[model samples]
Target chain A: MLAKIHITLKKDVLDPQGKVIANSLSNLGFEGIQSVRQGKYIEIMLDGNDKNTATNKLNEMCEKLLANLVIEDYSVEID
Target chain B: MLAKIHITLKKDVLDPQGKVIANSLSNLGFEGIQSVRQGKYIEIMLDGNDKNTATNKLNEMCEKLLANLVIEDYSVEID
Candidate 1:
C-alpha cells in the first residue's frame, strides 16, 4: 500500500515563502499572478494492509510527525 | 485564477529525506510503512485569465522557477 499526504498551512497563517515566490514571479514577468501558498506532498509506500488500518496508521503519523497541527492541516489517501 | 502544482523527484534519484522519514516512522512505530518520497505542493492564486493563458503562465513558472526540471516533474492545475 501507498499513502499520499498533503500538508498545507492554515489560511490565517502568514507564508513568507509564498510571498517571496509571488514577488519573484512578478519580477520575472509572469504577469497576473497574485497569492502563493506552499506546502508538502509526501508519498509513503508500505507493507500490505487493509484500507482502514492503513488510514489509521497514516493519520497517526501525520499528527505525530508529518504535520504541525497548530498551523498546518493534513489529509491522507491510501492506495 | 488559482494554480495548484505538485512537484516530485524523478525515480532514479536518491531521496535521503524520504529515507530518513521512513526510518523515523519505523522508529515511531508506524508499522507497515516501506518506502517514502517527499515533494512540494504549491498553491498560487492569481488574477483572472483564460485557461490557456493561465496554463501557459503556470507551466512557464514551473519550468523556470517552481521545479528543478533536471530532477523534478511538476503538474499544474488551474482553478
Candidate 2:
C-alpha cells in the first residue's frame, strides 16, 4: 500500500518561503494568485497486511515522526 | 475552482534533497523505506467560466511557468 501525506504550516503561522513565491508569481503577472502556502508531499509505501492496518499505522507514523502537529496540519490519502 | 498541481523531478534526474530525506527515514528506523523523492504541491484558485477552460489555462500555466519540463513532470487535480 502507498500513502500520500501533505503537511503544511497552520494558517496563523508565518510562511516566509510562501510569501516569496507568491511575490514572484505576482511579478510574473499571475494576477489571480492571491497567496501561496508551501507544503510537503510525502509518499510512503507500507507493508501492512490490510488497508485498515495500514491506515492505523500510517496515522501513527504521521503523529510520531511525519508531522509537527503543534504548528502544522496534515492530511493523508491512501492508495 | 481550485486546481492542485503536483510537480516532481523526473526519474532520471538527481534529487539530492530526496536522497537526504531517504537517509533520514532510514536512520529513523523506517525499515521498508527504499527511496524518497521530494515534490511541489501547488494549489491555484481560478476564476474560469468552466472546468474545461480552467484546465486548459492551467495546463498552459504549467507549461509556461509552473513546471520545468526538462527535469520535472507534473500532474493536475481539479476540485
Candidate 3:
C-alpha cells in the first residue's frame, strides 16, 4: 500500500515561510496573490495489501512523529 | 481562485530529509515501511475568478520562483 499524507498548519497558526513566499511573488510582479500557505506532503510505501491496516498505521505515524498535533493537522489517503 | 501546487524532488535526486524520517520511523517501531518521500504543498489564493488565467500565472510562478527546475518538479492545479 502507498499512503499519501498532508500535514498542514492549523488555521490559527501563523506561517512565516508562507508569508515570505507571498511577498516574494508580489515583488516578482505577480499581482493579486492574496495569500500563500505551505505544508508538507509525504508519500510512504508500505509492504501491506490491506487498506485498513495501512490507514491505522498511518494515523499512528502522524500522531507519533509526522505531525505536530498542537499546531498542525494531518490527513491520510491509502492506495 | 485557489491554486494548489505540489513541488517534489525528481526520482533521481537523493532526499536526505526523507531518509532521516524513514530511519526515525523504523526506530519508533513502524515496520514494513519500504520508503518515505517528502514534498512541499502550497496553496495560493488569488483575486481572479478565471481558472485559465490563474493556471497560466501559476505555471509562470513555478518556473520563475516556486520550484528549482534542475532538481525538482512542480504541478499546479487551479480551483
Candidate 4:
C-alpha cells in the first residue's frame, strides 16, 4: 500500500520562505500575486492488511517524524 | 484566483531527509514502510482575467522563483 501525507504550516504562522518567493514573483513582474503558503507532500509505501492498520501506522508516523505537530498540521491518504 | 503549485525532486534525486523520516517511522514500529519521497506544495493567490494569463504568470513564477527547476519538477492548478 502507499500513503500520501500532506503537512502544512498553521494558518496563523509566518511563512518566511513562502513570503520571499511571493515577493520575488512580484518583483519579476508576475503581477497580482497576493500570498503564498508552502507545504510538504510525502509518499510512503507500506505493507498493511487493512485500512485500520494503515491509519494507525500513519498516525504514528505523522506524530513522531512526518510533521512537527506544534506548528504544522497533517493529513494522510492511503491506497 | 488561487494557484496551487506542486514541486517535487526528480526521481533519481537522493532524498536524505525523507529517508531519515522513513527510518524513524520504522524505528517507531510503524511496520512495512518501504520508501518515502518528499515534495513541496505552494499556494499562490493572484489576479488574472483568464486561465491563459494566470498560466503565463504562473510559469514565470515557477521559472524564476516558485521552484528550483534544476533539481525539481513542478505543476500548477488554478481555481
lDDT of prediction 2: 0.75
Model 4 over residues B12-55: C-alpha lDDT tens digits? 88999889877877788777878888999888887766988898
The top-ranked prediction according to DockQ is 3
Residue B36 of candidate 2: its Cα lDDT? 65
Task: Residues B27-74, candidate 2: write the lDDT tens digits.
Answer: 776666556677888776656558887677667767877789999998
Tens digits of per-residue lDDT for model 3, B1-79: 8889999999999989999999999999999999899999999999978898889999999999999999999999987
lDDT of 2 by residue, A1-79 (tens): 6778888788899888877766776777666665666777777766655777767766766787777999988887788
Per-residue CA lDDT of model 1 for B1-79, tens digit only, reads: 8789999999888899999999999999777777999999999997886889888888999999999999999999987
- The pairs that clash in candidate 2 are none
lDDT for model 4 comes to: 0.84
**Taking the true A–B contacts (Cα pairs closer than 8 Å), what share appears in each candidate?**
0.96, 0.39, 0.97, 0.93
Give model 4's TM-score versus the native structure. 0.89
RMSD each, Å: 1.1, 2.3, 0.8, 1.8
Docking quality of model 1: it rates as high
DockQ of each: 0.88, 0.49, 0.93, 0.78
What local lDDT does model 3 show for residue A75? Answer: 96
User: How far out, in Å, is residue A17 in model 4?
Assistant: 1.2
Q: Number of the top candidate by TM-score? A: 3
